[model samples]
Target: MTIQTVAKQLTRTTKYRLNNGHHIPVAGFGVYLLPPAETFDLVYEALLQGYRHIDSAVIYGNQKEAAQAIAQFVKDHENVSREDIWFTTKIWNVDHGYDETKKAVEKIALEVKESIEYVDLILVHSPLTNKEKRLGTWKALSEFNHNPNNGVLQVRSIGVSNYGKKHIEEILAIDGPVVVPAINQLELHPWLPRTELREYLTKKGIVIEAYSPLTQGRHLNDPELLELEHKYKIPKAEILLKWSYLQGFVVLAKTSKKERIKLNFEVLPEGQGTNDPLQEGSNLGKIDLDPNILDALDKPDSHLVFTWGGADPTEYED
Candidate 1:
């Protein structure tokens, strides 16, 4: 598609259709490590910057602040409503059993101070917990997802984060998955693309939500990335964001700075032209990065997961 076409579509509504038939905004703001004192302000700023999707987790311990920010943003903006925003939270590692997982979800809803009906998505934070506990957690999430008369905690969708191919196989090994995962949130970026896992999930119709799409600022100084930035005349961060978007992954770009938040969402301007060598027309808009550059960005490299303390599911055992 032409850059102008892409820009128009992004502005009109860039969304990914999940397996459950629900739609999530293609771009989201993550509140992974934001301090409780600043989570509300940062999330509120992000909403003003056109971020319709906000990602949080029970482990992050900022659900209340993020939720309050969303609530306040909706109250202030007449055109926006609770349904317009996509809110995602997760069950922590400590809460890995069936009962514990259910209670964790309820606790998140209570902390957010919103009806469970308003929470858009919930996830099993990680698969590093034992197989039994992991499966039990999935069972709890499935119950909430498939139950028609579920009270207060009506999770619209359930998914996993940091789950590998083996972890997914285990989930599917059940007689029949009550609710198929709609998405898998992972630490994805050009440096550590997780190509195998992405392909595995893609074949199953599960969307990939890319966290640390910017590599947590580590790629800012990389020679290859800097070359792309200079070649495209776009900021390094924008380059990374576009790379993830072009790969058909939902990108979660997090920043506490208001200006950076706005810049992250400004992937492209409407009807703008670029000097990018990849452009064949007058209007290049925001997607000016060259295809060859993207190819180089995807080249295999040493694994570099910047956050989460190197937790791997393969090492977990009962």
Candidate 2:
């Protein structure tokens, strides 16, 4: 499809149907480096601003705060319920073996049971372990996904993170009928698009969740991004987010500021509400970049790649 076609199709509230038949919001709020003391209030504010998806992980150290925030938001809202929120958490690298993974997941389910019903999705945080342990971890997650009555861990879908072609192929090559991963959360931005892997995942029907889609605001001052910001009068991060959504990837935006959380989720700046007269005849009239600009932002040269957190586990040998 053409860039314009993709742009026209994308909206602030688009949802992608996962391979497991569950739908995930295209825009998600992530709390990666958020301070433990401030996670609750920020996450609650994100829910109040219409973010239905909350992405957290064991490594992030704020999963409990996030769960409580979701639970509280549902209780305080009129029609919202546990089902209205999509809560996702990941198993850390330390918990990569079959037994270890099971224990970690069970611990998560146990810890958050009082707050939320069940985790919407659980992903192996990274493919940092050897093949044996990686496949073993996937096996455990697959079991939990297939057997709902497996005690407390009622995960709707299971997936992987930071997995590359070889890592995914290892799971696909299993001898028996293995449950294919529903999603692959990855570090994606204009600079590191992983073109080949993205096409591979698309063909396999695995949804790609764009984690760090904004480059963690590290390179928001790129000349090209600045150009778009000036031309569109929107924040550089929004432009990067639009580029990510336009590519049919689920976007996870992390922010601690209440206003930026809303802006990131809204994809529509404060004064540019949908009812604004300027957006009358436009499709998703929030912040539509020209096709040429989108083309330029489609993954830059190798030297320009910006891997947030100073590490790219997808390329890990293990």
Cα RMSD, each candidate = 5.0, 4.7
Candidate 1 deviant stretches above 4 angstroms: 1-12, 113-117, 268-286, 311-318
- What residue runs in model 2 are displaced by over 4 Å at the alpha carbon? 268-287, 303-311
Candidates' C-alpha lDDT: 0.77, 0.80
97, model 1: CA deviation in Å?
A: 0.7
Q: How well does candidate 2 score on lDDT at residue 120? A: 93
Candidate 2 structure quality by residue, lDDT tens digits, 129-150 = 8999999899998898988888
Distance (Å) between predicted and true CA of 297, model 2? 1.8
> Whose lDDT is greatest here?
2
- Pick out the ten consecutive residues of candidate 1 with the lowest summed lDDT: 272-281
Clashing pairs in 1: none
